[model samples]
Each structure stands twice: as C-alpha cells, then as structure tokens.
Target: MRRAVATVLASTLLFAAAGCGGDDSGSATDGGPDKFKVGAIPIVDVAPLHLGIAKGFFSEQGMEIEVVNTTGGAAAVPGVVSGDFTFAFGNVTSLIVAKSQNLPLKAVAEGNSSTGQDGKDFGGVVVPKDSPITSAKDLAGKQVAVNNLKNIGDTTVRASVRKAGGDPAGVKFVEMPFPDMPAAIANHRVDAAWIVEPFFTTAKNQGAKVIASNFVDAAPDLTVAVYFTSEKVLKEKADLVKRFTAAIEKSLQYATDHPDEARAVLSKYTKIDAGVAEKMTLPAWPQKVNTASVQTIADQMQADGLIKDKFDVAQVLP
Candidate 1:
C-alpha cells in the first residue's frame, strides 16, 4: 500500500485489459444470461468454483462465467476494481491490505479455510528431503519461498516461526510462484517454500518434508482467502452480485458434500495429477467467511510490518 504503488494501481485500472470472457455491459442489460468475468488462480482451493460451473450452479442462476487465471489474488485486485472482473478470489491478507489502502473491496463469500490441524492443513512449509532444517526455527537467516510477499504466505509463515520460538524477522522471504517452489527446493534454490496443495502434496510425493503448518499456526480454522468484488460492482449491479453470491454458497456446500468429486474436478482446469489430487488435503469450504480468523490475519499483518493501520475486517466482508 505504498503511495507510489497506489498511484500505479489507479492508472492501471483505467487501461486494464479485458481478458477472455463474455461482456457484462451488453449481455447483462440485454436480458440474456448475465455473464461474469471472474479472476482466480489455478489451484486446488478454487476447485469448488469449477465444480459449480460444471454442475450448472451458475447457469441455474441465469449466469455464464468466464474465469481468468491470475498468479494470486492480489494480482486480480485491479481487475475487480476496474470492472474487468465481476468477482475475484484472493487471500485474506491481500484483501485486508487492499482495504487498508482505502481500496473499495468487499468479500462476497468465503473462498477457502485451513483445516486447523497441525501438520495436516492444506497449506504449509516444505523442505527438501535431506535439508538440514528440522523445524520452523531452522528457517532463521535462510531463504524461504512464497507465492506472494506481504501477503498470507509470508504472514502465516512468520507466525509459524514465531510460535516455534524462532525469530520471525530473521527469516528471509523470496517471491516465487507456487508451482515453481518444489523445483526450487529440489535444486536447493531456496531453503524452504510455503505452499498449498496440490503442490504441497506433489512436493511430499517427491520426498519433501513438511516442516511447518503455517496456516494452522495463524489461527484456528482460518479463512485463508475469499471471493470478493469491488464496492462499485456491489452497488451498481446489486442483483448480479446477489445471484452470484447465491450460486457461490451452493457451490461451497456442494464441494463440501462431495469431496471426491471436488478432487476429481481439478483435472478440468489444473494440470494436477489425478494421484496427487486424490492424496492432497482439501480445505474447508464453509458458506460464511470466518471474520475472527480474518481479524487474526489483519493483526498478524500489522505485527509483521505489512500494514500500519488496524484494519477493520467488517469493511471488506459482505
């Protein structure tokens, strides 16, 4: 949320590229099914969204969805703000940071949650099989890779180090995509990598060791990320937002009720192997976002120097 970054974002919004998708402008008003451009990362956490689309949950609501893949939620913030994306999936830390910057963002639905189990949650830190790092404390002064910096990956990873009696500030964090992390670890490019499934499972399948369950360390049953929209969209397209939210709730429930199908659906949009998909741990998909857990993330961000102000989680929750 630096001043220069804010300035750049504002400018970027004006010229944001309209990615693949049906137009919401004409189709929405022409009485045809409302088309929505959604931004999402290609990860296991987004399985419910794809599963729902396949099940016609969105079509049932008289909507057609076009999902635009981004590296992370933070990258899609501008797309949502600019109306290029009707809604986007993002991590809680990224959304809160956007709110702290006075961005008009509101989380419309819960995206994903941690399993709240030590060493068993969907997101954690992994190391090469023969690496000397044995615990969170060992990450001190060592380079750790994360999908995004100043976001959930590093925030929760620092929490894990702190909880394990390590100097959280002593760990060096490097930015790298989730998919590239396993290879980085294998080649000793980094000491450890904070990752989520199927990468977490994929790394373990390659004999990697799980050192810390960072998301679980962050908070109990933490709401890791959420589906959000810009405030402008909510106010301007109230009915569209309402229908999309309803479809999302049903989709979350469906994913929860049928976990196997949810795992099976990864093949449609992701390159995750079927065996890894089946073995990977799935996150909780509750209909409601965990406000308390989100508050915890906000608090962690401030403690970690990622944010300055005390973020009001209510400002972002719909």
Candidate 2:
C-alpha cells in the first residue's frame, strides 16, 4: 500500500508542477478547452481537490480550472448558486438546509468521506489531561466549545452525549473558531471542545484527553462532504461537471494510495508542515456517490431541524 501510494503521489506531483505555467484565465484551456472556476473551503476534507489541480487532473480533462478558497460551508452555497463558482465543496448538512430554502444547487459529486482510520471524521470532545471530566456523561453542566453553533461540531457532540447515555442538552455549547478552541479550553472559557483537525491533533499533543469521538457515537458512513454545482452550471456545462468529477476522483485515488505524497502536495498549497500533515488522520475518498450514505446525512439533518421540509434522498444524491 505504501509503495503504491508513493508512486501515485510522485506521478501527481510531477503532473502538478508541469501544469503550473498553464493558462490562468477562466476563458482559455491549455488545449483550447472549456474554462471553469471551482471553489473549496480551506479544510483537510477538500485536500483531494487541491491534489487534483496540482496533479493536472483538470488539465488532463481539457479544462482550464481556477480554485477559490471560501470562508466556510455556509458561504460556499451562495457562491455556487449565484454562479460565482462552477462548483463548490460544501458540507452535506449545510447543503440540505440550502435545499430546504430552495437554493438552486445540485450535488454533483462526492468529495471526501470521514472515517475512524485516524480519528479524522468527527472531532474528539477533549478536556485538559488533568481535568476531572473524564467521560461524556461527566460533561453535564460543563461548557463546551465548537467551531460554530448548530454546525457539525455541536450536532455531533449532542449525538455523542446521547449515545453515551448522557443528556444531549445538559452541556452548554460555546461557539469559537478552531484556532481559538484550544486557548478557550486552556483558559477555562469552556470546559472542553469538540474540534476537528489539525486542532484534534494539536489538542491531543497538548495533553487533552478525548472523552469521545464523533464517529464512535454518531452514525458512521455519514456523507459529511460533497461537491455542489448550481442549476445554471449543471444545465449549460454538464460535460465540464463530468470532467471535473473524473479529475477529482483521480486525485482522490492518488491521495488514498499515497498519503505521504498527498501530504506533500497539501503542504505546498496549505503551508502546513509536512510532519503535521502526515500525522493527521485524513478522510477516505469514495469512488462514487452512494445514496445510502447521503440518506444518512439527510436523516440526521432532518432530526437536527436543519431541514424543514421532507427531501427525497434520491433527488439529492448524484
């Protein structure tokens, strides 16, 4: 597995380096092809998208691709719906909420799916190693920090608490960006934090003891992330969407086969240290959209009140 991963990574890195000087205009393809502008969040889940670009996957499909980094999942929806991006990497929960409000978005492809391989999917509800709150049930009345209110962090933690036979509503959830989660916990602003990488790795390195992981308590095989395109783009550029999906899939395969190479490429784009990137638990890349997997997400969203009206899972899954 390691050897195969390295070979794929090496090939992708060479491909990416060669494509660097290609056309940047959204108008011209290297081989007189269609132009596209793809957007993604600056999170690890979208690393395969970066890998695709760097590995010349888009170029290989005769596409002139430009990538934009957005603020968060919530912001990505508007950009895609308004045609600011041909496609955007968004969270499944956020997409469901947008669809509930009649956003003109269609999920065109699967990005990365979370797994328990290295603790990558859901974050650990962590407390200082020396703290007395050693379990999920012990967190009652304690303050917990999350990246955002009513987002994945909160939802996952609530589910985890219930799974542990604790009251989901017992803990108070405080909202804070990932960068500040550690400090907030350290300063006693919150008793614990439900955090994702690289904060998950960071918190543990700082002697934080994990009380629970989201995947362990929440539903496994959840569709945490996906690639979404607007109705406008879908109608006018279905071919481009297909090409993009192919390139993305190739990139994902390469990343899965070559973790070290993937980490190196990610470091080039994200500036995260090689060591830290390698140490972090990366998500698994699914080859195709699984309706069953996505249905689980929709079900969770409906239960969380993120989606108001009933949605047919088949209509949403690409």
Candidate 3:
C-alpha cells in the first residue's frame, strides 16, 4: 500500500436573490435554534470561521452553522442569492459587481484584508524560480494567470503592472485556479500566476518566486472578502443575523488573539498541511466590516470597467 499526499479544496455573487428561510420562532436575545447555511472556500481567509467553530463561538451564541465548500466566491454567490446559503464568503470585487448589476446583497461582516506591512507575504504574482520576469514590467507581452477575471486579480495585477512601469494593457490574463497555479507555472502554461496564501507558500516551496506583491501595491489594507446575505434574508432573519454577527465578531477576535490555534483549525477544516498552514501569511481578521475599505474595492471595479456605475457602499453594508 502506498500513501498519497493530500490536496486542499477551496463562491460568487448574483442578483435578484431569494430569502434563505430561517427559524422565525427562534429567540433573538438568547442563543436560539436559528441555523444558517454558509458557502465558503476552504482557504486561510476563512480561518476565523473554523476557529469560531472549534471554540464553540457560534454554538454559544445559539446558532448552528452549516458551511459548504465551493470553488470560489463566484460559485458561492449563486448559492447565497438563491437562498441555498444564508450567507457566503466572497471577495468584495464580486460582491460589488453583483451589486452594480442590482443584486440585493448586504455585507454583514468583514472576512479578510491584506496586510500593509512590508516584506510580509500576503499575495503576489509568482513566476518560475529561473524565469526572466523580474518586475511587473517584465510581465508586459506575457501571459498571467489569475483566479478570476474582471475581479480582484485582474484589477490589482493590472494596476501593479502599470505602477511598475509596465504596460498593463499589453498583458493578457487567463483564469486559473490557485491550486493548479504551481504546476501551470512550472509547465510554462502560464507566464505567471497570481495567488494567495497557503498556495502562495506552496508555490514558493515548489520553486516559484514572487515577482511583485501586486495586491498590496495596487490595493493596500483592502477588505478583500466579506460575509454577505441577500436582502430577503436580512429582512426576514434579522435576529439570526444579529446573533451570527456577534458570534463572528468574537470568532475574529479569537483568531486575532490566537494565530497558531486559528491555523490549526484551518488545517483541520480544510485538510491543508498543518506545517503549511503554520507558515502561510494569514489575512487580517477584522472585527467589523469597514465601509471605506469595501468602497475602495468598489471604486477600483468601476475604474477597471468591471462595474458600470458607482454605487454607495453603505447601501450594501448592514
């Protein structure tokens, strides 16, 4: 018998969503039998959620959470909109795009944000160890791989490339999942790959090197992801939402205070390597969702042509 190495698994936003029916008889003041379904990617950004579960944060608040793993936010969004998921984890860019298209979604909490500290690894464009690409400028006339198009990757990478004295318009972006990025870069299938943690650590350990920290450069202290639900869910399940938010805030605080324990929870939930989980750069787990941070992403989407009109960020924040 041979043992095999394990692999890790990883949502989206949509418009015109339905309500995920909840327990109307549930107590709001005390923790009740209110249950909520959540769609999420099994990534480090969601470490706090797992940490909360392990610490019984949600249970203590009288909420039971069912977290479903999806490919990314794009896929997760549909679940959230159709009432299949009461809430979901998604990048702000996708949420903004959905909102721009008239989706009745509201961000209930902040999920993760990039670190502003220098020399700290958050996310970046990674190239083969010996690849000639040195800076974002070297990426001109080359192909790049991003997890999604017209979202965070496209917006930030292009901005960073231009800031590096490169012609971003000259670069082409292809969608590639983060898990496959290391092999893709090694095979020369993609000139470079835009990736985030755990995968970012994996890429580096597998002979890939960072070309530029594009995300932080293009957008610093950005609220990359959020916890969101549809308008119907918000209106119908206000009590559940309130309790969930309070529980999540406690979870975030726990994750912030106990980084190692949070990483351990991430590994347990996602089957990610415990060692890798320990080394990965964790996103900042904010206790509250900052409207200004989210607004920055919306503004960038508009400038990048991902959104047609500028909308008030407050409208989507609960």
Candidate 4:
C-alpha cells in the first residue's frame, strides 16, 4: 500500500521524492522523482484518487502523490497557483472564476459530475423540518449557506430559485462548510444550505429536508469539479502530466467497477461512517473533458455576475 504524506491547516507535506522509492529510476517511464503535491477536499468525489493510491496505479506509472487536504475548493486555488501543489481538485465554477481573473491554470482531468435524472440527487438545498421556508421562493430575503461563495452552490441555487418562481436577487448567500450546515439549519443560523453527499445523507438523517435538487432544473449533468494544475506544470512537465492523467483515468475506471471498494477507500480518507459512505450518492467520473457542459456553467456564472466574462474552455484543457 502507498501511504501519502498528510498535512493539516492546508499545510504542505512531502510524501516522497520523485525517484526516491521503488526501483525503475531511469526516468518516469522506467517507473518515478515524478512526485506530485495535490490539494483536495475530503469529499466523496475524491474517492477515485484514494483508490488510485491504494491500488498503486500511480506507483505503476512511476509517480507519487502527497495529498493536501483542504476544507473547500477556494482554499486550494492559491496553493495551486503558487506551485505549492502540483495539482489540485476544484469545482468548475471556481476554476472559471480563476481563469477570468487571469490565473494561469489548466484542468488536466475531470472529477465528479451530477448524475442528472429524476429522483437522483448529487446536490440539493436543505431546510429544517419545521421551518416555514418550505420552497425556493421562501428563500427570498433569507440567508442560504454554501461551502463556497460565488461558485457552483451559489450559482446553481440562484438559478434554481428563479425557476421556482422566486426572486433570486433577494436571496442572501453565506459561506458555511458542509459539516456545519445541518447544525446551522437546526439553530436557525441559516435558513437553508446548499449541500452534497455524504453530508446530504447526513443532513437528511438529522431531520433536515430537501427542498429541491440543485441541478436538475438549472443544469443537469453538470461537470462539478476537475483535477487541475498550474500552467507552468502543463508546459514544463508534459510527460509527467500525461502519466498523471492516465493514472487518474484508470483510477476512475476502478472506482466505477468497484463502488463498494471505492466507498471503503472514502471512509479511510474522510470522516464518513461506513454506513453513510455506503448510502451516499456517488459522483459521476467523466474521463474526457466536456467543453459544452463546462461552457454552460461559464455562461451561467457570467449571467449571475459571479464572473466578469465568459472564458474559453479550451484554454483550461490539458
């Protein structure tokens, strides 16, 4: 088993030097000093990455990964831009915002996407069991909690509210981590929360009720997140980049083929109980980049005033 170097407070941890372990050593192809520092949140979307580490798919490619655990995608941005992390995971909305601000980054691989069908849930808005704010329109002049401000959660919720005959302009959004959302709703700290699994599963168990599926009406099958790296890494480490993505694709396939095993790995990395991990709605892993789906988000963000301009999706692809 490959043990990753772990760190807290978004601090950096060095797992292994590029060619420090294992015996190929003749360059990465000989199988790896192809070491990577990655920033990620401990959400179920990242199960495939953990699976890759556990199965040694990266090791097979002569690469090693040191995962930097973060609380949200916004927190991971600076680290990736400053080269503290060679790669990181983030929502597509956040990435688009970053690109609009001229951040030199590229998305090397896809992460989790919404399953996009009736009665299927990837993300939703939750309210207290007895709250009078029973529908999206009730959210007007109300505070809604989201993990990151001006990203997927905020954009999707606003779109959803408008579709539900509510005034999206009147709703106020606040930033709150997923773990704290259930309690926030219980205590009336916030009126509602935009959340995803396994916290969605956890919140429902805590007496919170889902008001609406966040994406189904606004934009179904949305590409929620991706694995990205700095522009410098894209230009300077071409071979290593290719190898890294190949490993990611393989890991995604592994997770799809062995969901139970993937959930087991998720429990090891996240605080989720085995039962919650088993019951949570897993994210769809798309290996190929969907420019059109990503464009849909960029267009939405621009309309929502979350970003200044629509960006070229091709510029972010690796």
Best candidate (score: TM-score) = 1
How much is 277 displaced in model 1, in angstroms?
1.1
159-216, model 4: which lDDT tens digit per residue? Answer: 7898889989998999888888878887878889998888888888888888888776
Q: What is the TM-score of each candidate against the true structure?
A: 0.94, 0.83, 0.88, 0.88
Estimate, for each residue in 42-130, the C-alpha lDDT of model 2 and write its tens digit.
Answer: 66777778877878888889876677877556666656655566778877766766665656678888877767432445357888777
Q: What lDDT score is found at residue 54 in candidate 3?
A: 76
At residue 181, candidate 3 shows an lDDT of 87
lDDT-based ranking: 1, 4, 3, 2
- Which ranges in model 2 have alpha carbons more than 4 Å from their true place? 1-33, 117-122
* lDDT scores of the candidates, listed in order: 0.86, 0.69, 0.75, 0.77
lDDT of 1: 0.86
Q: All candidates: CA RMSD in angstroms? A: 2.4, 10.2, 7.0, 6.7
Indicate the residue-level lDDT of 77 in model 3. Answer: 65
**Residue-pair clashes per candidate:** 0, 3, 8, 3
